[model samples]
Target: MTATPRPSESGLPIEPVYGPDALDGWDPDEKLGEPGSYPFTRGVYPSMYTGRPWTMRQYAGFGTAVESNARYKQLIANGTMGLSVAFDLPTQMGHDSDAPIAHGEVGKVGVAIDSIDDMRVLFDGIPLDQVSTSMTINAPGALLLLLYQLVGEEQGVPAEKLTGTIQNDVLKEYIARGTYIFPPKPSLRLIADIFKYCKAEIPKWNTISISGYHMAEAGASPAQEIAFTLADGIEYVRTAVAAGMDVDDFAPRLSFFFVARTTILEEVAKFRAARRIWARVMREEFGAENPKSLMLRFHTQTAGVQLTAQQPEVNLVRVAVQGLAAVLGGTQSLHTNSFDEAIALPTDKSARLALRTQQVLAYETDVTATVDPFAGSYVVEKMTDDVEAAALELMAKVEEMGGAVDAIERGFQKGEIERSAYRIAQETDSGERVVVGVNRYTIDVEEPYEPLRVDPAIEAQQAARLAELRADRDQAAVDAALAALKKAAEGADNVLHPMRDALKARATVGEVCNALREVWGTYVPTDAF
Candidate 1:
């Protein structure tokens, strides 16, 4: 009896073996250019990790700002190179802790940041000038960014000195994450405003990390991920350009975020293809002349959806593999998911272990010595070509549908991703795909594990803090600033300017967002089959 060969997560057939024949017509000069050059398939930088290892950025935040701040300090102490903040539902949705809708979920998944005071406490002892922070907040990204800037100025860190990224990719929110606030047109206006604001104010900051991580988490294949993400990137560039900004002015600051799955070879190829595609799009399509604008620098997070709760301890191995893939794929930075993530929010120890995973890969392994280790591998090169071709096909479809926003409106990306997710679920359920500990390995009894639990009292405490903030803050100033913000949103002015003033005047997140909501209104998705 012969054994059946398995397929990749993208449904690509896995051959028994691949050799030089696999890439018969492949040209190294054209397909695999020198690192840091145009069509950057091999890697983005010339030295890659040889100069310095990818920034070990760990994603963390839970409970109150003080608690989350403790975690950040611990991560920094444990040698994390950067901070990636995860905001709770209320904060992500632009709600204050005291809002009726924010009840019972003040700080369950991440820190609840209602006002500048919460942002202040979140980075209490951490110096804003020194640490690079990545905040995973959409819909109200500009609001959170202004709060960060406010906190930085309070700490005497100039705007130019503050370096970080905001996952301000709202298109993905509509397609997968479902945290969108306004309709597409208004949402895009806000994003364009962010680009204009950042180019002038925070030159060192990565204005937007156009993300495909959430789409992948929602079950997009590697090709689909790159295609949809790049399409969204195209939309953003167009929006900025149409708003009278040169492509090079803000394109250099654009970054990307993606998932690093356990499928090492394909994940590597996906990253390579993404860079190549983005490089061409920027240079050929948009006529961007800056080398930075052509480079597709991205941060990678190990796939959380791949982790299994059935045998949670096995997730450590899974994370190690995913982290390795991200490193080998030449990520600019990385965030390794904690092993216990499948069960609950990562405890302090688990978070440390996750950071240690990246440390081990960086310091303990020789993989960092070379740039593009698999540059000449026949299989990898072929996979890169295959993935790029497939992604381009998907991108062309999106183009025909009038780009990402139009395609999204027509339910193209969402429907495609849903089909992919359904296929994967079917494969897993039918045992056609073996998820080691999930489906194949049987366990009668599970080991004892004490997961970190958020305190229920956090809600009341946050509400009290908000009450005090409202009592002590200059209400007149907040009202005036918010009025200006609403006026800006209603007109052609960049809203971030007035939005910053509103935040500086101690306006709450909900108040600022509500002011804009009054002008731009909210999004109501139309059903599309």
Candidate 2:
């Protein structure tokens, strides 16, 4: 007899052969009506990629604004459809590049932006109205968005005309990522304020990219990633409605971020199921009337965690497969990870290769010719239902714990993810899971690879920039604006309006965040939450 088929990544057993009987009781009218319609199980858009390929947004930035600006220009020249900014640790954590906590980490992970001066340089020659930008930032997302708006206004572009997204989901920070700034209560308030501010000012902008990408990188199973992410999305919607905003008003602007792994089938199923869940939740639970509010439009990034330092060049193949999975899953936009990422920051050549991978998929493959190519396939449809049920069970548990915030405070999500991570690690070590070049297809004395590295001197250069900014700006204006910001944060006023004034006065990001911290305090994780 043949050996039993292995389980999928979400721990669902894969049947050796999937026939029509696999979906015997499935109802096409109820489960999936049509592409771009209710539930959105097939795809969010009717034409899907047949109309046009998804935006090939390449995420890049490191060292300083000047360096990152050069890279952005290069990416645009090389056919990147959109820009995705990656901020350094300091900027992500609401600290200036020169802060003591920011010491050596100044510009190591991503680009350093301390104030509007840097923000202006980051988009120096780039036209804000023409290009779509997605900033991978949270906590201080408001600060960066304000800075971009100021730059756009200076370039004669109105806030209404600017289009882009900010990864403003801070709840995920409490669940997986450690870049949190304020405590949960105040953090939720800030997010609600952002939703209202964007609706009134930057109506075209996606206010928050409620993300599960980080959780997946941190080793969450596909089901856990979708479940925890949707839970966070629901929490954000509730907070906005509680803050006196209509569900349809802010919900339409909401977007999501997920990771695409090399497991193509499971990844596709995960995305389809996630859209159905979000749509049902919006209509049934939240009473969202707008169709846009029900659509789970998302941006997908290929799995960086899956890339290996051993035989790093092989990551190119892995990335291609992952990107294909995302495209097949019908992502609205995608970011393909550079092959060289596991070693260090991607070299310019590797970054171009990542974008080219998407181009090849879009033009050279027939996957873009149809909407939901896997629809009606026995295996895919069955797996989609299985993943959907598994995710709903997890979401129900989250609701039982009084929603995402309550579950986070109880460390429920984090604990579950860690256990999943541990299992993966154990499987890999036991050779039960094959990771090519690491456990299988091993090679001794791998070829020498020189990865791109940040200049340590860049930190000192940023410190100098901060010093010059301080000496040139009017201290009184900054102090006054920051005081107003503090007053707004302490009370019921929208913090972004006054916060914008502070940045307009050339106030440093760290300074504005510090002012808020004094009023709101910071988050300290106690045991995994």
Candidate 3:
């Protein structure tokens, strides 16, 4: 007996099937090229994972500097190839741990790094020149970068030799995260200054990591996340070009950050589409001649939102699927979320298991031997094309309305994201979208999940150390460097150079932010925008 097929609201098959015909118009010569070639649709480098595998980097930082540093070393010993630091709310908000606004928040989510002294403790034994670091900071990126550079100096490693990434993507901060401190213009100025400083001084450092991870985490659909993120990237390039910097010089060092969701093939298609779209934007619209400018190298973190507090072990399977999607989609670096992530910060035991998942994939799976293994799949190709076309149409709408910055100011992107978010939430609520442990698979699963608990003693220790540093360092030198920093901010000068000087003189992150706050004031977002 022939069975009747169900239909979806979009008029597609309910259980949609795909075949070679799906890639009928997708040209091999035009779209799918060798790895490392122009457009970079396949992969970034020719060897791909054949020569060197993607870096296994798990995001781990919490509590005091010493605790985070210990965890870093532990992860390194466990074969973590790179370090990704997660700062506490106080650090992200540009406040000292002792500040009244910082109470109870210090060391709760991530490490509390208040000054250069804290920075020193954070990397006490780790060699600055050897290991690459990525700081997931945005609002206080300038101050953090300054401290990082000073750390390099103290370690006798010159700025030019330091290699790392600073999440200096401030635009998404306003739209999704709300971690922004300064107004848009002044924030852009700070980002530009970092771009300029790193271009001239720290050649190996990634000046900015334009991120869409938080956006997706905040409830954006995969399509809207990539589209809006690329829009912000284009706006940044335009702003940099207008700042009188050569496109090729700084563009290559620019990187991206993305989230790996559990939507297997859909996530893979989103990543592939993102690369092609970014390439076109850089070449066709921005007039970028360098192929490096067209390559969209990104770091991927498994979606934290997908983890469920109930049946947390199920999250391991989800993260594994998401991590596979990231690798197949060609991520340069990957961070697999821990199974216990939905409950609290991961314990050492849980973090190692998450890292081992990546290790097994890299070594045992043999997925790395081939580049773009699914490039010719009708399903993948068609989905990639569709996503690219949809994103481009949205981008054109943005262009007509003035550009990313203008659109952001008008809240167009924000409104669209919010709408999409609402749609997804409604779907989940109505049982149309299934979240296994949370919604579909009903069970009173009361497993005693182990969560890494940070003691309150961390804050007191950090505060005491901060006090000691203030008393020990030369107050006059700190005052003088801060004055210079304020003067530079008042002028057209790049603030990083003077800020680095202040960091080197033992000025705290709060002091440096306070000095700038006095000059540029602080950011306050209106409901309209």
Candidate 4:
């Protein structure tokens, strides 16, 4: 006798086998449209990997600007096509390194950037015109983007030549990440301003990478990830339209970020379902005519929360599986987490190994030769339909509650994700769910491995650098620019213009944020549980 089959992470029933019967009424042409066409379920580009492999962007940032800059240069030398930056907690929260709250945390999680000086050093030898950069920032995304533009200008690179993305999805922060500064109202306004600013100034730049990665890390199922993320995308579109922007003007540049787990089949289905749903929404609901506006382009990062600390080396296999899932799911860019990530910052050796994993996938594997390899597979099509239905149901609930922002204020998304996370924990504790090195193939005693440790002295060094900047810079100019920023924030003007001027005048990240914090108070979440 065989045991009962377990359900998938999204609670979809898994059968012993799948055949043509699984897709009884599925139409290949309608559901699985050709790549780069409307309802882009197969892949975004028609040629997919046939033309070129996905951008290998390993997320790397640690210590001071000088330290992180070296890592980037090394990555470029190793044939990395794009750069993804990870900012420290202080920088993410819009605080300077010298702030009281940012003392011990400086340069611990990622790199510390206090001002334009730090930004310049961060991209020292990197040619802004030649490389694409992605900054994993949220609350202060506009500020960071402005700093990058300033750096590019100093390097003689035109703003129009700068191409990259800023993770400007602050709604997810209120739900999961907790890097949010101002309340939802001001946050949405900032995002709208970014859409407008980037559309006019940096035409090639991706305005916002509306992200579901954080929600997944917080324990959302694949279905929940798609539903909430797409709902957020809807809210952003509505906000931009209300802000007097055309759908085609900014929608083409809007991108998404997701997490790829070891569940290969389900992940591929999730990506397909997400694309189909988004295309329908853009075409039928919003009436967008531009093909690019309807495309659901996204970046995928391997699930960091799934990495095991017990047997660190086993994480390499985990990352490889996760990376493969992302590729199969048709991600535009990918960042493979290092094996040592669960313990601490990745060492140079471990980081290289992580990049090598992508190299092997792009070069050695036959997975890239075909577009949407799982297109006609019975199980995949059925899974895609199932995921889409589940996600649409969740999205309907969100719509009934007004939209993503309203649902977020009521803690709907957060509550649902927390419940799913609790279920996962319960399953793991009961041994119903097996994690290779963590629960099932457990080792009694793990091998000792040295992980990368950030230097605590870097905090003091960053503080000293800030002090030097303050001493040498023109305080009056910084004050005037900040006052202009405050005026713009209080009024209807695009705050990024003055914010850029403020950073150009040597204003610290904390100062710029505090100026806005004064105008629009910080967010304080209400307990829903």
Q: Give a tens-digit lDDT track for model 2, residues 213-315.
A: 9999888999999999999999999999999999999988999999999999999999999999999999999999899999999999999999999999899
Model 3 CA lDDT for position 312 = 88
lDDT by residue (1-529, candidate 4, tens digit) is 7656558779997677888899898888899778889789998899999889998888889999999999899888877758899999999999999899997899988999999999999999999999999999999999999999999999999999999999999999988999999999999999999998998899999989999999999999999999999999999999999999999999999999999999999999999999999999999999899999999999999999899898989999999999999999999998899999889888888988998999899999999999989998888888999999999999999999999999999999999999999999998888988888888989899998888889999999999999999999999999999999999999999999999999999999999999999999999998665
Candidate 2's C-alpha runs over 4 A off are 1-3
TM-score of every model?
0.97, 0.98, 0.95, 0.98
Local error of candidate 1 at residue 256 (angstroms): 0.5
Model 1 weakest lDDT span, ten residues long: 1-10
Worst 10 contiguous positions by lDDT, candidate 4: 1-10
Where does candidate 4 stray beyond 4 Å?
1-5
Superposed Cα RMSD, model 4: 1.3
lDDT of 1: 0.91
- Residue 238 Cα positional deviation in candidate 4, in Å, after optimal superposition: 0.7
Better of 3 and 4 by TM-score: 4
TM-score, candidate number 3: 0.95
Q: Choose 1 or 2, whichever is better by TM-score.
A: 2
What's the C-alpha lDDT at position 424 in model 4?
92
lDDT of 3 by residue, 4-69 (tens): 544321112322567777777678768867788867788888888887778887777899888889
Q: State the weakest 10-residue window (summed lDDT) of model 2.
A: 74-83
